[model samples]
Target chain A: MEFLNASVIPYFNYWIYVVLMMIGLHAMITKNNLIKKLIGMSIFQTAIILFYVSIGVKTGSTIPILEHHHDEGHAETAHAVAESGDHHAEETDHEKSDHGNNEHAIEADHGIDPDHFANPLPHVLMLTAIVVGVSTLGVALAISQSIYKDFGSLEENEILAKIKQGGPGVDV
Target chain B: MIVPFDIIILIFLVITALISLRVRDLLGATMILGVYSFLICLLWAEMGAVDVAFTEAAVGAGVSTVFMIATIYHTRRHSSD
Candidate 1:
């Protein structure tokens, strides 16, 4: 079927990703509050994540888990075997039934059903981004908290006011 | 055959973005921003980017909006006095 064909152009996703990236950048630059800035940062980072994941996606792809189910009637297993087109599937299926704990070598190595192979790089990048985003959030929140403590308010204007006033005991 | 839904979704996404920028009330503007994300998510799904839609729906609509509102609550709710 043409629906399953991989020839369809991917245009809308690219536009959405670009728009979202711009929106996040606008928010980060325009917003004044520290927390809002962090939110903007998260939005910016998440936009890139969306972009990566979208670019990596292929139609009819499934979760990259190697289903260890050894039941002979499993359609997913049959599909995987049929798609992989190698004796490795039979080996996996046969080995999985007799020695359930021996799937590490088979599952980890190769023959991952070409039609269903997902680009895992995006997922890996997103995992890194999640960590980086949280770290940034933590630092921003700490700075906001410190600014609040020093100026008695969190507003950027309030902080600026204290700085402009040359108030004692308040460090800019 | 190409679906006309793409044009419709793109138009809606642009409209929400414009509305988000034009709105006066900060609260309303933030709400429109959420709608903007939703529309963009739809656009991603249309382009066969389900993973992108998933991230946008979760982070943009869900987390980003919450943080925006929370920041608003902590700061001034109204625009410049």
Candidate 2:
């Protein structure tokens, strides 16, 4: 069918991400062990990070750093051309060149396509998310350890049973 | 082009995820989860997310697995559910 055609190849990476995400979600929902649930959560977080990083990819593009030498060369050439021109013809040519240079300056200022660099925004944000995930995992593990000390088991059912029976130190 | 490599890595990822979930022993599952993290880290590096790949390697594969192992040391490894 149309969905099986060649056009779908470009988006195959997204399909893979979705599939991985769903697998992690299923594990998180159905898994009974606390550690298994944490593993599923980690898988889910990685999948989302993959999705964000994929969005910033551009074929044949380099990193997001300005090529100062290239820009300097272009500036010298533009200046040279501006200096060696007749008055009337120079006016028209200068106007066109000025417009082009202004557009390029704006693009460079915004880091939109400075020397074909990839977007750096997602990389920054995902860095924060990764740290947050680690901290959350640490806190959850600490709580799980406490649960084990108090209830003597990691299984959800056993923990629930202990709570239902009004075991000592089971106020929460 | 790059699609073939992506597909192969994705297949491995899916396999590791399923295995991690299917394993009965919590310790075994933790090890498999470590493998899953490693594979995804490679995939991220391949996709040009070097920063993310580095973090996943350190946090997901290294620290998290160690934390799980330590927790297992404190508690039982078998799952009754």
- Candidates in order, TM-scores: namely 0.55, 0.76
> B6-41 in candidate 1: lDDT tens per residue?
557655765676565545555676787788778757
Return the interface RMSD of the candidates, in order shown, one decimal each: 5.1, 2.1
Candidate 1: misplaced stretches above 4 Å?
A1-12, A33-36, A59-113, A116-118, A131-135, A138-158, A168-172, B1-24, B36-60
**Candidate 2 residue B81 C-alpha distance from true site, Å:** 5.2
State how far residue A130 of model 1 sits from its true place (Å).
Answer: 4.0
In candidate 2, stretches whose alpha carbon ends up further than 4 angstroms from where it belongs are A6-8, A62-116, A169-172
DockQ for every model, please: 0.20, 0.51
Model 1 iRMS (Å) reads 5.1
Instruction: List, residue by residue over B1-81, the lDDT tens digit for candidate 2.
Output: 255787788889889988888888989988999999899888767766667778889987899889888888888898754
Model 2 lDDT, full chain set = 0.71
Judging by TM-score against the true structure, name the best candidate. 2
